[model samples]
Target chain A: MTGNTAPSQADARRTVISVDAMGGDAGPAVVVAGIAKSASKNPDIGFLLHGPAEELEPLVARRKTLKGRVEIRDARDVVTMEDKPSQVMRNGKGTSMWSALESVRSGEADGVVSCGNTGALMALSMLRLRKLPGVNRPAIAILWPSRNPQGFNVMLDVGADVRADAEDLLQYALMGTSYIRNSMDLPCPRVGLLNVGTEEHKGRAELKEAYALISQNAEKANFEFVGFVEGSDIPGDIADVIVTDGFTGNVAIKTGEGTASLLRSAIREAFEYSILSRLAALLAYTSLSRLAKRIDPRRVNGGVFLGLNGTVVKSHGGADATGVSAAVKLAFLLAEQGFAEKLAARVASAVELAQDDATSADADAPGDSETGSTN
Target chain B: MTGNTAPSQADARRTVISVDAMGGDAGPAVVVAGIAKSASKNPDIGFLLHGPAEELEPLVARRKTLKGRVEIRDARDVVTMEDKPSQVMRNGKGTSMWSALESVRSGEADGVVSCGNTGALMALSMLRLRKLPGVNRPAIAILWPSRNPQGFNVMLDVGADVRADAEDLLQYALMGTSYIRNSMDLPCPRVGLLNVGTEEHKGRAELKEAYALISQNAEKANFEFVGFVEGSDIPGDIADVIVTDGFTGNVAIKTGEGTASLLRSAIREAFEYSILSRLAALLAYTSLSRLAKRIDPRRVNGGVFLGLNGTVVKSHGGADATGVSAAVKLAFLLAEQGFAEKLAARVASAVELAQDDATSADADAPGDSETGSTN
Candidate 1:
């Protein structure tokens, strides 16, 4: 086992990140702010903002003091968050988001990050970029907001493959584990299966089968397989990675965001209604703000689409300047660290752990079980 | 349209509610306590317990002088929460919970309640009682604790059918609306499809069709069909009834429950171990307690399986007497208000609204698009 390898990975950084310029309500403004901040701080980094050159001129003009690390590429249309992805994929060749993804696929950009239409990005990336060998349907791995000292946990298949079979779930666990250990650099990163209960026998039939396969996998033995974790555990880092169906993961994370939002609004709305309450709220402002910041979504900006052939990071459609900045940094870090190859290797190693169970005829022949040696 | 028949739909049982004697943890004890509390002030209401002779004897002996129109029935064996649903239906011939359901089915009991296995009650109820004519799948509906004076906004299909198409979602929306409109007695319950975003085209293809169908079904307009709602809106009562796939719904509710548990632990752990922090905790006790109560899962017991042929309420697996009592009230309300029949008509009327869209062909679909549903 290659136990330690960070120096060699960090040295690889002719890395260029492609940002979707026309994405988000804030438009190129926030994306520009984020890219400007990233480029100003990191001398070695470079970025290609893909969108209309005319529109980009005004945004880039404001950042005149920016160093030579920035450039712009023009493209025609923009994919709104509300566009039908199926139709978009067929006809949106002119979209800058599409062009940005093309740059990554063609090896012009090391990675692509977008703050607009997550559904469109995932569909286009998987279609144009394709899935890695031994990877099934590419899952959208999103990092949850966290206040814990351990930081964010990557929740997989947030929307990539919604209705997952047992094998699909197992693959998610494998890929998620690799992403955490390789990209996040956690030692023997802990893996937790999200479930309604902690009991091994709990949950659906598919979940039960997946649990057995993951639990019994000898390759997974190196990592701390922490068993079942409930929803809130995702934020708490009870495990470094939480595996779930895309539907649930999406709902849970959005729910967390919504809950935090509602709480903040409730407090604000409460204070807004009365003078006495406003005075009390003023007194409580410091602690409330501290608590709000503790659960703030912006600090953790992007969620990586793991198991894809190349790196793709998706920022929340509603992300602001700070959030977009964090996403850019995340993309850079992933590129510099060469987490893809490392994660792929680690995940490939994990597949070997289930060989005993795989000896049973049907197991070895299905899905992404085709070996790298098959080549 | 029966546009103004709300008052006649009010529950018939103006006084006490009869509960399943052998339901939930601390069956008689907690039920006895709940009965005591609910009945203490009302005085006119009563609680009827149904269970095995021996179990009721101890509770009957212990309560001594407790009131609320307490009554008992003889039964045997418990339908455990962990039992396979098939076993509960086929083999639990003599179980107390089953017998209680039979009572409700027979109209001998005003309602039946059990904290035993959810899948079991749902299956058995359908097996024995079947569904309301237009209802293909039964939905489990419960109130999520809310901040508003209304207490909770109803969330349907907590875990009824693990896989459901858009038709099922429509059914949930319609049935849940009827419960809110006729039973819970809300005026024009706003229906929202639970999803990842509020954008028009933000979900799987199945949901897109469901959204279109919901929008197109403008005739009967069972309730004002609000467009997509995300997870964050659930606690905020963004709509009176929120609908989604049971799989995601179940996961979301469990996530919320698990989150509340984790937060409680976090609050305790954060404050415990030191003197000044302990003092701070004491100062914040009331506010913290209010938060705890607001998120308490147990306070609202049983999730009703709406659209079933007959009324069946699934109590939380870990429910105590309090939960059991709540389940009883839910069941009683359903029975007293003729909830199922009203729901059946509402569903039939809703089907009429979407007659051209086709409910039968698209029922219980698992994110499959051909039939038009995937959440």
Candidate 2:
């Protein structure tokens, strides 16, 4: 319906998403197709497609919907999936991922999307857009299909860094809350610190400290702390946001994905087991398809890089057109909501609040300040 | 059938499994029903059912198959799920869980099966049976249904302890191999160190050290080292044994279970969405049941405690009769194969071999010995 709006008005207000066209396993054509899909769906969406102009220009030209809505930024080098993050940081100046991020850093694009090497992309994004002040570690937050009313829960630190301490975990809780508020449109998200058990006394020492820190700051950060939640709670309706160190979060997400894939295959095998089952499969085709669409990984392809100066959605490297389109859709939504800037402001204020609390406590117990420093 | 074997001969060589009948969410009735199911299937199986005698006697008496197979051990105190592991270790002497482990400690039972509080059972087991000579940490290994020929993969350190160093990880690999050998009849299992990425340099410092340590000892330990595996590979056919620290493993397994459950419910909802789907479900009943049977968590219900003096299978605290029976079957099979003694011997020899390698290397380069010791 918005497509019927005046062309000049839509063009003037178009939200431009910078994309690394050459980063994905499917290459530039798929990326172009994805943007075309977004362009067809939303009149106010535009793209700054980054890749070798010689390769990407033809792909963009082939997509009718992207006729005047796309601009190709010529970046010759491609950051392959095999490139190490450290290596990419040093020699990644000319890569499409770097160039795409440069658009966001230079204020030419609202948000960036890339189906590149995750580590390399994160490294370049940090190098270009930079980390938010007072943020120790930027986290990769993904939407997990869940039993929540919103149909998904936010899980953070899915692999920005392998380790997170008490302070870093507190930052994640704040960043995760910001992510849910902007992206999911929840005013006050329920945040749960991931652990082996929900009990206060269970899990590692760092988790206990983090639990206390997160609990203390929850009200100030405008989120409800759900205390400790186990891995089983990730897909449950108990919490809208699950926070953990990247190592544990990474393993959890991958394990969840693997298990879901295994079950999907097993279900297909079940339906194809016999002639009667095959007939049943035909009869239940629409229902099964609806279910598949609901749980499709492609539908939730973006992993938003949080605690950064700008929004970046890292699409799955193996993502096809549909997956890439989903990622672009996510980037557009976040950009439209001004998610990155709002998150930066939220984190800045939270950090100030934390410091203020610490300072006041120190002033109140000047003699015991030395003992408090042990924490 | 084995049930037709001479009752006197069967009684002479019966494998007695100590069970904490008062444990489990479903209470003593489910535990009794579980052992009864196992007793019916295996003529050479006997149970040392530990609980309040007056309470358990009537439950066991109702099952005709368990009439001559079960011996009720009166232990007044029941270790509820709320009891802390530390508290249990101090005052758990007269509890049913304690009495169950005592049977194994005193050699009255071949192995112990308990659907009790995991922390309590593990703490009591460690206190009573003690750790094996070479093991720094005892791990809880569970059979994860996978694409492996054996139908499952063995994952260790699934909540026995929250942390594991390089040496502890190596020990898990060794213990995991031993478990596969005895339980799944794999002569030399392929072991993979679980990490965020399969790449050699992609994880934490301890994991990298563990990778090198595991790879070096793989040949000597008589198992194939698959280097590193991501969480996705846990359910894949790439390796038979996946080892990690308890924190990650605990999160991973639980996440996998949660995801599977979410999918199962989604599938059920899909089938019940409309009249056509409901009709399809009716037609595909047998095929769907077969698939359900294949991936049923109840069929693989036990988490085996490894690197201990005696075998203990911690059945799910919420296990029903079928789940309990599955655990009992696992315990009986392990007991019949003398798994505990075999695992101890294997671990001891592996430790000696590692020591031998270190000693020889130290002798070869005395100057560099100090640096090697730094590991």
Best by DockQ: 2
Clashing pairs in 2: none
Worst 10 residues of 2 chain B by lDDT: B366-375
User: Runs in model 2 with CA error above 4 Å?
Assistant: A1-10, A361-375, B1-10, B361-375
Candidate 2 docking band:
medium
Model 1 agreement with the true structure over A292-342: per-residue lDDT tens digits: 565566888788888777888898778887888888888888887777666
In candidate 2 the C-alpha lDDT for residue A184 amounts to 70
DockQ of 1: 0.25
In model 2, the Cα lDDT at residue A130 comes to 89
Candidate of highest lDDT: 2
Assess each model's interface with DockQ, reporting 2 decimals per model.
Answer: 0.25, 0.65
Each model's Cα RMSD: 8.3, 5.9
